[model samples]
Target: MRVTWRDHSPHSEAFDDIYFNPLHGKEESLYVFWQGNLLNEKLAGNVQTVFTIAETGFGTGLNFLCTAQSFIGQSKEAQCLHFISVEKYPLALTDLAKSHTCWPEFKSLSDQLIQQYPPSTPGVYTLAFLEGRIKLTLIIGDAASGFSQLSAMVDAWYLDGFAPSKNPEMWSDALFQQMARLSHKGTTFATFTAAGAVRRGLQAVGFEVEKRKGFGQKRERLVGRYLQDNIPEPTVTPWFDLPSQARPEQVVISGAGLAGCTTAWALAQRGIKVTVLDAADKPAQGGSGNPQGALYTKLSVKPTLQSELHLCASHFSLNLLRQLDPEQTFWSECEVVQIATDDAERTRQQALINEAAYPQEIVEDGSKDTLSKLTQQTVTHDGLIMKLAGWVSPADFCRALLNHPCIDYVPDSQLTELTYQDGMWIVQTAAQKTYHTSTVILCQAEATSQFVQTQHLPLKPIRGQVSIIPASVTNQKLNQVICGDGYISPPFRDHYCFGATFELKSTSLEITDSGHDTNLHNLAKVLPDLAADFEKSKHLLTGRVSFRCSTPDYLPIVGPAPDPETTLERFAPLRKDRKWKFSNVSASHLPGLYVNCGHGSKGLVTTPLCGEYLAALICAEPLPMRKPIHDALNPSRFLIKNLIRKQI
Candidate 1:
């Protein structure tokens, strides 16, 4: 977003108005939003543990910064401040830091925010501060569209945007309707505008709004609470509805790889006890054991479910990595240069950049010369340089996530049977040991299908091999991670990890010589000089092989496990007439059973975000993604599709 500065004050160029009161921006934000919504008094009490706030325009983040600081010092009990804000034109990182210079008291908190700020792009960027006590979800999109996609119940609202006359479209009935849909009976709202159109628009959407004395030069403002949920919400297929589960006290998680460890970390952060059962001797012995895995995604030319997931998950994972390793020792932000290896791929890359399918900060056009210059070596393709990606140590990440005191790791305990009685699941291991919990989450990739409830899940195993070799003998060092059909990670721990061959037909876990041969051949095609160096030292060749569980569609499954017998019987009429609406009946889910698997090769990018989504659902908190995207990742989607086609 372009901003014009007038004597150290921020002004929006698109709306042709000032961002806040120039002389009293801090005081004005506190008076209008903090006090208007009664945040201090509400936060000081122990009635609620999580106080969620939603805002319209996050022009300079003035309201958010004020509330974050206040919540930290004023709250008597430990509480989390969940702030969600929407913006179409997000400020650039440099400009955001520049704008915050006006407030010196928030230097420490503002610095943390700057460190976690995401690129100016359209995605859900959630940042954490004060050790998870505060979470800021920044949705970079239109005000109404962003709110419509969210599935949340807001406690307070900061309805601060450009003046109603300046940005008339944002202050319409459509926006207010969404506000009412996301608000409960006691949800409160405060706005800096007192326009009659806004008051009437809010009243038309079930909000009891009234005018109050305005801040500084302004004469009047509006404040109110949602009296009821009278606004009509869009209809959703009942089968895709998210089933409610109680806040789990003790949880059992199978497998300790990325899926398991990440979920364990998410739960442990909320003061929940988790037991991670692993078949192997320790964590990261499965698909997550690779020495190095690149944090990247191959964006599709056309927008598809996979592309949407990749775009959003990539952003979420990057932020997660930074939070995990702030010093950048186990990971590197050197960026991934995804080369378009052929003319067809080059054309697709051009289309992706030219059509502006993504924002400029996420990706840009690249040339062969640019690739060579970035890597400091010979390269052979023009590709899209992805700014939001790099490489990470999957093994280290899993270990760090499982290091929490709240997580109990069980080794060599392969799951044997699961029995449900008294509303609790009993998990029995091969060692004849049993554990009980109210909730059981299956993160054991393909092994989840061993159970009757989740056996219908269409999870397939794809074998992959990554060959690791010592540093290249070439004088030039690999400056960044590079990708073609496979990826090559930069030097770390005295070795250059690269060459992951995708084998669809192979199931054996042995690292065959032929697998290394296929990887070397592809490396030769992409970078001949590096291949020659590796060829000179063939005796040093070594690799690891693992199987990635994936579904027919590439999206990861993250939701309740549906009971196939009852769910199939309930929606059986869809096979006779595809237009049939089973709106009254939701899918029958196995009580307290959830599964998070089928990530395939994108586990590094998709696991953490999906884990967060599952944790939010279990805790009855706001979701972290769009509604359609959440449904697209549902495990029951394939069942519904198959029933409609009479294939199951």
Candidate 2:
């Protein structure tokens, strides 16, 4: 049966499954055995967490969209539903939108997906929806290879491919073997094909295959479960012997910057009582206290893994801010303009606008005239404007997270030391006052080096200063956030904030004349009209300086930090040969300990998602990102990479 795909419109497209004989109607193609069983059973009710489902092929994403609609209709308390799908050939974003229109019921869900679909990349791409509850991890690659590399357990599997005959590669014995390798004992699977080869392949590998009444005009379909005999059990590492449950009801978080407050909010949501220990009287007195900051997605034309993560994080952060109260929290809808001064940047932007289907209405090209009108400044160049991007008060946002009912704001208390005794982490202040808790999160910015456990971790402290200028009536209330060599936010509360000078050698928190002058010089490039305002506000130009903690590769250090020596020894066999199998080995994990720092300049965009990621890791819930992003942000990535690099 030859299938016909219709590129219905510039924004829509659809393809019929030639092998699937629909007995119902055109809509019957949407029905598959796996989808029916998943929808009928209340699997999430028995589990105390956000359920996750991973798929092999996302040709049209029909299976995922259908599952999302069903999951939403079923449970209200289902904290989150994560659907991760892999596809080698992805359609254009506009084509996806067009194809999605065929399903009226899925319009709302598809609309959201089409709006935030990431740029095409070879590695994993994550998109968050429904306020971070529903997440999609789309890995654009071959199913067999992708599934083998994936690190996730699927509750239900939609084994969708072209057909046993037409797409034999998808259902080959090797592929089924890989699927069996990834399946847990009770893992369930369903497919439309009842072909003898498929059944034998599945049975040969551990699945207890069963025939079911087919959907539409088809007479039969197949569904099955991984049996104990064929399914291999995971080997428990010595480190995993540690308790996996939540330590206690209480935790002590040191530091009150964005990192600390975000961690506090995450813990509070989990019903964990939190006491924030800060040296200063208030939160955001550190690196997070910047008066104005820009929020923009970073993309690379070469399509690297880092770029993919940033794109996902940027969109997730933007959506998260939208869910919060604008007035209480410090945020603005000021658009971000990425000026095209260099050919390299211009080429990158052009590729992004052409291949990636961003929320178009939110990002567009601005002529010099349009730019001047929007920014209220003379512009000599054209640039791409991100309408959804803007600036936010990092300090105010930190305060909001600390305001939760489960949080106890402990000010003027600085952490002096950390020691584990009586199965509790005791955090002592300089005055000898100690606070005890089973779990402790270090979010003290660059001061994290003071902690014994993380002292060996490679983190650098770079000082940065931001100057404030009074908004003059003629200062032109800039309508959008502008950026060139530096950036400036629209006037807020009678003051326009700009000028951020980065000095790696400087460590003092005191503001300096040189730092102020450097900021003023940088600010003149974007808004030369403000040169006079700089002079007027130079005397009134108060500034704050803080240190930003960053890792070598720039990815945040999140998830469990296993004992370094133990991990190095456990996986030492891999150092000898690249053929070592990780199938049976479990990575070691430190008991009741994790880290969520080293966010660098993307603190606002990555921190909230990092909080969610940490919660998921603690709960052993399904991960929001695919294996690559998880591995990228893994706390031990640096250590493991260094070991691998050393062997070479």
Candidate 3:
């Protein structure tokens, strides 16, 4: 059947479901037997961790909203409640708001969900709600096709598809069989259908099927349990042994930019002493000292692994920034306009907007006139406006993060070398002073490559220079951040920061007249009215230059590093034979050595989240993101992939 969004407004006469029939006052259908009996009590009472519930059809999201409300009332002290559902034909954002008005009792829960609902993508879209207590995973696609690729275990089943005669695909034997494969032996399933094929298919997969009273004018429904019938249990992967606990006293970090300050804060929070060493006279004096940086997010039309990971990190970082002191740190809720320079780029943006199912409030179509008004300029092209995007001061945020009580600020101290001896990582300064700690984190930007241990790592230094200009009263009228070929921030600190020149071949940190002229020329293209102010800004264009350390793929290298040769030799057999097994194998990591570097251009958006992720890994806490991100940022990934390809 061709699918469309179901109208769920209480005021609208089209909203009709027997289970929630106000006229009949709540009757039981097979839908109740399947959803209420199987899912609610069975898996909830048994699971030790946060219970996650996923559904294929989220028509009005009644099933998920109801499940959340019930779980909150019944399961107290449950670590978290996760309700994930999908809808191929999602309603407009306004329609969702109207539908939610029907349930005033669930207003608080619905409001939070509505606020962070991601733009619809073709694949999985994960959302965190209730201050990270509840998670919602939505996969908008065909039920059978979507479930087959989903990698989550369900404790209970809610089989509430349309009637088998009307929507046979929803209740097909193949679908039931797939569900059987996805469910555990003790999984209880309930459905409003008592069809012979449904029962037979479930029973064929070892479930004990039974009939029950149906809800809402329906005569009968079915509920069943998967019983073990002497089949062998699946083999579980052996858990890796935990690393030996280290003496948690102190750590020495060799940088004072965003990465170094963030790591220092993470260590300080865990009751560990932190000494941040840097050659600059003050913190954020390097690449992170940009006057204003944009929180840019690159999203894809299809839910690729990279897009998924970025969505999670973006939201996490946004929320983390909200909890900081906004006065001392510069952050704005202003929108960001990602103008399409050409038709091809516009097409890509349109495709992403449709797949993303982003709220209309967050992303909207813009005309050239609207763009001109938003940027306070005369002319502009049509494009997509991202309301959730904004700008922040990288230097100020770094300062705020490093303001913790347990951190010691040791600026003007240049780190010369790091030596691991006698169970301690000794860091020596240029003045012959030595500081010994059990853990050492390297975050000194491009200077990090100077260390002997990380000399072999592929890190390149690129110089970036941003021009500072005093914004006139007219220039200050610009309300939002604009991005075309280059980016310009809204007026801040009595001046607007614009025209950042990127040079990959430049080695000298000295500010040049040519670079300054290049910046002014670039700024003129975006804001032509500011031509008169350009010369005055040029006269005041005394700016700082810093080198950004970046990797080839643009993803940062985090986590532990092992000896390269040893890692290659150990994984060699697995490369030759995919099924090869090795025993008593251990990672040849440099003990207690970790690096959080190579953030590149997206440092403002990716760095803070990276710091949190590194902290979670070091402390052995539950990660903020799923498994793929953890793997993407793994320090050993390059070595392992190269070894597998025999290129190492």
Candidate 4:
């Protein structure tokens, strides 16, 4: 994670290039990359559409900064710019901040980039600037893996890898093939190297190559354009490739909870009008009605579908929550302490710290004494501290999301049935009133299973109850949220919220005295010191109960709603072979119908990103996360797995 700085230049001890031209890095970038790739012309050509630029290397981000400056200076025809770059080994934030100071002209932009630079986790990190007109997607991994996972149609390429002699792996034939896969017929690329291997590799991938005058001391550079007369189409696994309908002008979202409201805001940002319907009398009157909810990434030692999605969601959640609640009234990044109650948990926490390579600012190892000092409370065991994890008022956040001008939140409008006809979905309410739209997203939690079409989806309702404890003046020093078997929040407005008991196979919303006792028991197990104070005031405990829609594996079900009968018939061959091959099996969706539910206990951290994913699917934008994460959240995944095992 450290960048070795030599002579004020960031030298990659693992690769080549001083990251920039030491003599004049800014000028070299503007000339060789900006002018060489004709970014100004390409950006200006797309009057209203997004002009995408892909880079093989994004060392100190000099190329991106210069390109952003160029885009801002371009003619009025240009609207937006998307820069996607891959870096195998990322420079730490401190090093990035130091290297960026060399370019005083880019001071403002550099400061913003440094402020939002993500942790050293190897996944895609998205950042926006210039009022969302210019976007950057930083892929922190090897070139081929990053490019293969990228989900965008690129318009230009910044082949700024280290010299072909130093980092040939980045300029390999496989990399060129992936580039070709993401490019269109007119996609152009430029690089500082003119090696034969580079030229042949690009040409073999269908690009017409040429030699050009290089900038600075270099004599020549390689430039090329994708010119195959018959451009190949970008393809995914046929089963997962859902055909996208035209972006709807008006969308109807069921359930005005966290998922629905957030999705509404995301679509509204793209100028789409949204109508949010809820069965309750008000927004967040369901599972999201909680007084406070915690936010943190559910990570494991090794990357799995759930872990990857959790990591991706955690990053997206922080960036988005900050944007929406700039005043920090609805949520607070007050940090969280996850107490390790047993040796198993302590070892798991240690493995997470040592294996993930996460930035300390995001998550770090902590001792019992360190946590005690942080919370100003005595701790019996060590724990993992996530600096960014905290709590949010879900109801207030939902209200804020629905406050957008483009979103119309209708309360007490329960959707009883859905019928698709004439290329539009008709949503009928219990009152016999009907609403029609080209798109409908069901965010109605486990109640979504009541519909015959979605009955097969593996969704269950788990009842959860949280007991509220009045914080005494003596406990005012408890300044951080603490968690173990259950969680306890720091004093918030004369009281602390804690002790949530998860009850599976229960739909009852009645808060019981026994539930509060169970919570007290959990608190005693996690924090005995706090439990002693709570026990003396047990008579005053009050609580609330709600039901959360959960999946067996705990991952949320997002994306388009599949047609049950058709899907089973289409994938029937899976009964014989787990890896059944099918051609052109476009996703059999209940057209214009989608669902975002079953987020379970992680809705606060997961739903915001799930909202963005649903919005991207509807708007046909580049997905916020990679394809594998999408597959994990696919509503059809359970059915596919069962079919493969011949269980249905």
Candidate 5:
């Protein structure tokens, strides 16, 4: 999206300002939005909890910055702010930064926003400012669709779209209805446009509209309050609506792998004490035990639930890793080469490069020459290079997360049965150990479904073997993680972690010669010199094997666990008729049971975001992501989809 600059005013090249004036942009925003919405009063009144504000357009982000400045000035130190904005045409970072230069007072804030502004992917992107007290969720899509998928009850709204005459699509009745759906009884809205259509649309949606003196040269603007007789409820699909529970002070999480440790850490941040139970003697003794695993995200050319989640997780986890390993100990920030091994892979790579429009610092296309230079070896095919991707010792990553004082790690305590009675969960382990808590989170991968209550979940166990090949003269030259049919990590210490052959329906951890041979062959296809050296010294080869838990769909399951018997009976109408429609129904969840499992291969990238989301749900805080994302990862998605399709 390009902005044409004329007479020191930024105008959208596409919509031609749509009867909206950008002249005196900052001053106009302060008066029309800040003053019109009465934000000072709202923030002061809602001092104990989060104050949420929403906007129709995020053009240049002037409204957001001005509101942030006002919030910091008027609110107490403990107060939090959440700003949700929707934009169809997101300007490039360079354009946004250039436009923000008009206001010197916002330079510092503008710079930080530009730095964290996400790529032009059509999904929700979250950014934090003011040390996490001020959060912004940017929905890069049309106002109607974005608001439909949003999951927040707003206190104020800055209806900052173009003039109704210029861009009627944004001011349509559908958008107003969505606004009403996302508002409370007392929600207030302010807009520069005083169009009769806008006023009628708001009134139709139960808002009491009023004309106000306009800012600058304009004669009048509009401000209104939602005066609906009843509070608006979440307009989510019946199958996807999840009722949050009253938060518990203590929780017991099963599994001590990446998923478990990350979930524990997130809960600890919210002052929740946790007891982690693992079957193994220590953490990271399963799939997370990989000595060196690549931190690569699974991307798709077309935006899907999995792709969007992966993108969000990739950005978040990379930033988190940098913070945890400031010294880069056990964590390497190196480029990852995802080579195009065949026609399908080449097409996928090209589509990702052309369609994703990722920032150069995140991902970009790498020609054969560039790939050769980055890997210090010859490559025949062009590939996508994740510039921020790297490798980490999973064990180290888990340890860093579990070091929190609020988390208690109980090892070699395999949970055999889960029973809920009298509002408390009893976790019985195989070693005759019993632990009790008001809340329980299952993060034990495939074993998450082992409990009688969760046996209906469709989780698969995949066996994988990784061969450790000693670093040779040529292997030592490798500079980063490389992948084609398989992945090869940069030399960790004395060896390069190469491998992994995936075997389905297998849980055996036995290291077989054929697995090692398969890995050698995979390596040979990409780096013949390194393979030859490994074959020459085959006796020195060693390996580790582990099992990964996966769902039928690759996306992980992260939310409250569903009560099988109750859910099936409640939604049984779909068993006879697939087209059956239900209204205002929520998932039948077992009171305090949650699960975060089935990440499979992208665990390193996806687990951290899942952790944050799970924590928010448990603590009854505003969700970190949008509703569509939550629906995609809901643990009951499989069951609900099957019922909807009449597959049960």
Candidate 6:
């Protein structure tokens, strides 16, 4: 986005309009958006549990800052402000900082926002503030398409964008329809524009718009409420439909690995009591127990649901790691380099760099020289350099996450049975110890499907082993994590961890000599010069072997678990007619059963976001993901897909 400074105020070059009324911008923001939405009354005391605010434009994020400051002032315990905004042409960091200079009152909050501001990438970024009490989902794309992908129940709207005449796309019928889709009765909206077409469009979509005294010298502005929500929700894909549930008194997580610990952290921060159960003696004893894991994203050449999820997860995970590990002892943003060893891989990397249009702050194409410089070792192939990504001690991260005051970590307890009765879930471990809770989440990797409710999920187990090689004085001190078919981290506790063979056939938990040989081979391939000493002394390598949980589509299975017999019977009509729309049929789910496993190898980067998503869904807050991506990760997707294909 290009912005020009005029009289010390930021002016949008694309829309040819000023960002705000420059005279009293702060007061105008409070007057037109804050007080106009009646937030003073709605957010005072304990009127509601959560109040969501969505905006058409996020110019300088001034409105968000003002709202965040106010929300924290009035919001009490268990009350949250979920702020979402869409921006087609997002300003750069320097530009945003320059625009934010006009408000000295919002310096503290504005600085925090600036510090956490994401790279200029086109995707959804869910950021947390005030200990997750104030959430922000910034959609960096076109307003209408972005909101169309979002599934939220908004309580207020900040219609702040360029004028209707200059930016017609922001004031279209589609946007109005989306507003109606996300709103219900009593939902409020405040806009700086009072154009006749704008008022008519909103009224046509069930909003009651009225003119109010404008800010400053302006004559009038539009303030309204969503009185009648006539907009119809999707009749298709009802199996992926998500309805909110009440806040539970207690939640039980099946595993104490990355997924469970992160999930517990998310819920505990939201004031929910969580109990994490694990089979091992301590947390992160499974695949997440790797000595060091790469924190990076494998972006596709073009954007797909999988790629978008990765982009979103990478951004979220990067921020979370920093927040959880501030000292850089167990986590460090030392950057990561994924080398393309062969000609075909080089071509693919080149195409990704040329076609993907990703922000340089997130990823950049590495020529052979760039790769060598980043790794501080000699390399001959092209690669991708993840700037903000790094290496993390997964075990340490998980252990620290489960140390929350609201979390109870019970080791040596393997969840064996789950049954929901009388609005409560009875959870039993291997020793017949039973605990009752209102909700149960399965995060136990491959063991997640051991329960009857989740047995239908097509979870696959892939064996992975990471070899630990002692770093010698003669070996080069690798600064960044390097990846090819296998990955090697920088030194951790005087040992370099590498390899990790992804075997689909082997389910062996015991480490084998072949695993070490495979690690040596991959190490030789990815970094021949660095592996010279290790290859000669390969016998000194020892590793840890564990099975990783994956799905047929490779996406994590999240969201509520479908009732086995009921879903089979209800969706059986699809077998006769693939396009069958059971308009009268509603999907059935196991009351409070949810799944959060199947992270596979990207567990370090993906688990945190999925945890936040599930927590938001369970807590009845605005979701942390787009609707399509959420559906793609739905636990019932395989069932519905197979029912239509007549394979079930």
What stretches of model 1 exceed 4 Å from their correct place?
229-234, 472-476
Cα miss at 578, model 2 (Å)?
Answer: 11
Q: What is the C-alpha RMSD of each candidate to the true structure, in Å?
A: 1.6, 5.1, 6.6, 2.2, 3.2, 1.6
Model 1 lDDT tens row, 398-422: 9889989999999899999998999
Tens-digit lDDT track of model 5 for 48-138: 4568899999988889998998888999776778899999988887778877877789887787688678777677777767655787888
Please provide TM-scores, in order, for all candidate models, with all chains considered together. 0.97, 0.81, 0.71, 0.95, 0.90, 0.97
lDDT at 446, model 6: 83
Better of 1 and 2 by lDDT: 1
Residue pairs whose backbone atoms clash in candidate 6: none
Off by over 4 Å in 5: 6-9, 18-27, 102-108, 229-237, 326-328, 347-366, 405-413, 428-436, 470-476, 583-586, 624-626, 641-648
Estimate, for each residue in 27-131, the C-alpha lDDT of model 2 and write its tens digit.
Answer: 443466345345346454446455666776776677777778776777565456777787866766655665666677788888778866654545555566675
Span of ten consecutive residues with least summed lDDT in model 6: 229-238
| Residue 213, candidate 6: C-alpha displacement in angstroms | 1.7
Q: Ten-residue segment with the worst summed lDDT in candidate 5?
A: 229-238
Off by over 4 Å in 6: 229-232, 473-475
Q: Which candidate leads in lDDT?
A: 6
lDDT of each: 0.85, 0.69, 0.67, 0.82, 0.83, 0.86
Worst 10 residues of 4 by lDDT: 229-238
lDDT by residue (1-648, candidate 4, tens digit) is 455778898888776457888878878888777877787776656654567889999889999999888788884533677789988888887788888888889887887788678777777777777755678888888999888876777778999867889987788888998999888888889888889999999999899998988886789988879996444453445556655778789999999988888888888877789999898888898888878888876567676767666766777777777777878877777778889889999998889887866668678788989887887777889988877577888899899889898998888899999888898888998868799899999998988878877888888888899988777724546667788888887666677788688898666788899899889888877678788888888888888998888897788989898898888898898899866567666668889889999998888888988898788778766777887788778898888889877889
Write model 6 residue lDDT over 125-169, tens digit each, in one string.
998887777888999889999989887889999999899999997
Task: Choose 1 or 5, whichever is better by lDDT.
Answer: 1
- Scanning candidate 2 in windows of ten residues, the lowest lDDT window is 10-19
Mark the regions of model 4 whose C-alpha exceeds 4 Å error after superposition: 75-78, 229-237, 353-359
* Per-residue C-alpha lDDT of model 3 across residues 462-502, encoded as one tens digit per residue: 88877776775344467788776557787788877765778
